[model samples]
Target: MRLSTVILPFRRWHDGGADQWRRAEELGFHTAYTYDHLSWRSFRDGPWFGAIPTLTAAAGITRKLRLGTLVTSPNFRHPVTLAKELITLDDVSGGRVTLGIGAGGTGFDATALRRPEEEAWTPRERADRFGEFVPLLDRLLSQDTVTYEGTFYSAGGAQNVPGCVQRPRIPFAVAATGPRGLRLAARHGQAWVTTGDPKLFETGTPQQSWEAIRAQTEKLAKACADVGREGDGPERILLTGFTPDRPLESFEAFVDFAGRHAELGFDELVLHAPIPDSPFAADQRVFERIATEGVAALGG
Candidate 1:
């Protein structure tokens, strides 16, 4: 399976996120990413940079490593505008861009965007909005001129004259676990990303969590079949942010984790950011060790 790492855009990133991305690429990571939020819940009071500029800079600095937002949503930006931005990013990144999208939750981002209390989105409404958002982006990125008026958005003859560097569009890594969200991924995503059983990750053992995701991955295969997808549904991406507070049991867990994901048909694995400053001095030792030994063990 391919490997990616999400670099949190705090602490020593103000100068350049690219430096970290360069290191990730140098170490043989396939993709590099930043979290997409106006302001994330943890470190809300601390500094946080927008995902686009960070990714754009990452594109400028690196040639081999793919770049993307770990998850962007339609909370503050409309699909029409965001579509153009995404294409431009593809152009800047020379087509090595993947759109990792999700149904945005009610958190600091919603409040910072000034979403009205009366208009607060429930889980269903968030999913509904996301459902409209992805397909609209797909059309806007590929079609020369398009007019769309959905329940949540409208684009009046929007133009994408030259189109994207990637033919129809850049790859979309859609994040989902629910039926509706998974269906959307089956319809539009080149890659389907999941963190497994969302609540279970907080308390379950590593193996347990992996087992849960394996079941969900099987469910996704069924969803693909329902949509008449024959060969392969989409590239499966397992995001390793299930429990951010805890570190993996290092080499053994890392090797087994990547192996299981590959065996279960996952195409890529996205690692959560490790603590920049850890008592064991993890940032340097763990990642490099993973790159040299762990990934080798998994045949990455």
Candidate 2:
């Protein structure tokens, strides 16, 4: 099983991204990821950085820690431009990039471009849009040149110059909460991630969240089977923190949460690095403890 963490980019303004990710790699994290939002609601009032650029800079600093977005959606950018950026990131990282994506939320990300309210997307429309978007991205990355004309997006002679360092492109870590989204993950994901019931997190009950993950995994397994993929088709990634309601509050809680996810059939787990609010050394101490005593407690 693999273990990873999400570095909240807004929090890294003080320490800088390079130090944050390198610490994760040096501490034995398999992957390091950042939340991909144009403006996360919590930090909407203040400074925030772009997810792709933060990850690109992280790629330059770290050697082994696989880097990616927690979940990038087709809310603002076209698939063509995203494909080019992702492939270049793959090359720059020596193929250590994983593209985690999903059907976008209807928050600032959707309205950031100021599209018409009548054109505001329903859940079903978002699903349909996602279904179209992922396959096109798949084609854009794998093929040398792509010419696609779909209901949601179109591309003409879109060149994937030099292609990806990872043949057939970087692995996709697709996140899904609904059936339509689950099937998309089954169809194209190299790794699968879920945070369980978003509603359940409002109450911060770890047990309930774990149950949601278990149920989702069963459905995901069937999604794979329907498509003739094996039971363990994609690496299952579970996100535990990155939210105020549900966090790794204590060392014991962190170890317990991670182990149970492994028991529930998830192959990988992700936690949120503490927001840098306290003294710098104190904030880092939290990470150091998680990497050392916390990881050691997970058993080798």
Candidate 3:
């Protein structure tokens, strides 16, 4: 399974930024992901460096680690503008870019964008808009001139200056959890990443969370079959969670979990460390240990 690391810039963990990203490359991490949050939920609002700029900086620093936003909200920026930024970043990264996007969830405030709360659309609407927006963006980014019109957006003879650096097409992935969202991911995304409570595994034998993930995968695979897509369908299915504060007594549990996910046809497992207040002292020993032993157990 491919392992990736996520950086929470808002927490200010790494001081050297690009320099630290280089260090992560040396540690065998394949992809480096980042988060985008306009406001600090309820606490504060400040001049935060936007997702595109931060990704550009990381791309400039690292040689191999693929870069992507963990997930960007459609509410913040129009799909056309986002496609342009992603293509530019892909050029900067030497085709090492993956677009991870999703419908806006709770925590995002559109008021800053001058849109009222009621103006906020439901998750289903956002997903539908995203479904429409992505294909149009893909066409625009892939070709010179494009003309299209949709319910939410329209363009007439729109031509992007230069196409994306990625030869075929940039890899696209969606962060989804619900049924509609999962179906959307199967339809459009090259991968799926999910994180939340463990209740999803509580079945008869206390394996509800794992069962839920399996169920989602089955549903997604059916969607892929309906569309007649080829090759193991989506190449990756990333599961994110915090490691226990205490060391796991039996690594067997994790081994079994990985095997179960593999049986369900997941290609990767990503574990995000809890964000620490300080930069250099985040205590990565646990992560390092998992990389060393647990990865071996899972045959990564």
Candidate 2 stretches with Cα past 4 Å from truth are 11-15, 116-119, 242-247, 276-284
lDDT of each: 0.79, 0.81, 0.66
Ten contiguous residues minimizing lDDT sum, candidate 2: 276-285
What are the per-residue Cα lDDT tens digits for candidate 2 across 13-91? 4466567888888888888989889888767776778998898888888888899998899888789999999998998
Which regions in candidate 1 have their CA more than 4 angstroms from the true location? 11-16, 243-247, 277-283
* Reference-based TM-score, model 3: 0.83
- Which candidate ranks first by TM-score, i.e. highest? 1
Looking at model 2, residue 63 earns an lDDT score of 87
Which tens-of-lDDT digit does each residue in 9-96 have in candidate 1?
Answer: 7655546555778888888888887788877766778778888777887888888999888799877768888888888889999999
- Model 3, stretches more than 4 Å misplaced? 11-16, 40-48, 196-206, 242-257, 277-283, 292-294
By summed lDDT, the worst window of 10 consecutive residues in model 1 runs over 273-282
lDDT of 3: 0.66
lDDT of 2: 0.81
Clashing pairs in 2: none
Name the best candidate (by lDDT): 2
| TM-score rank order | 1, 2, 3
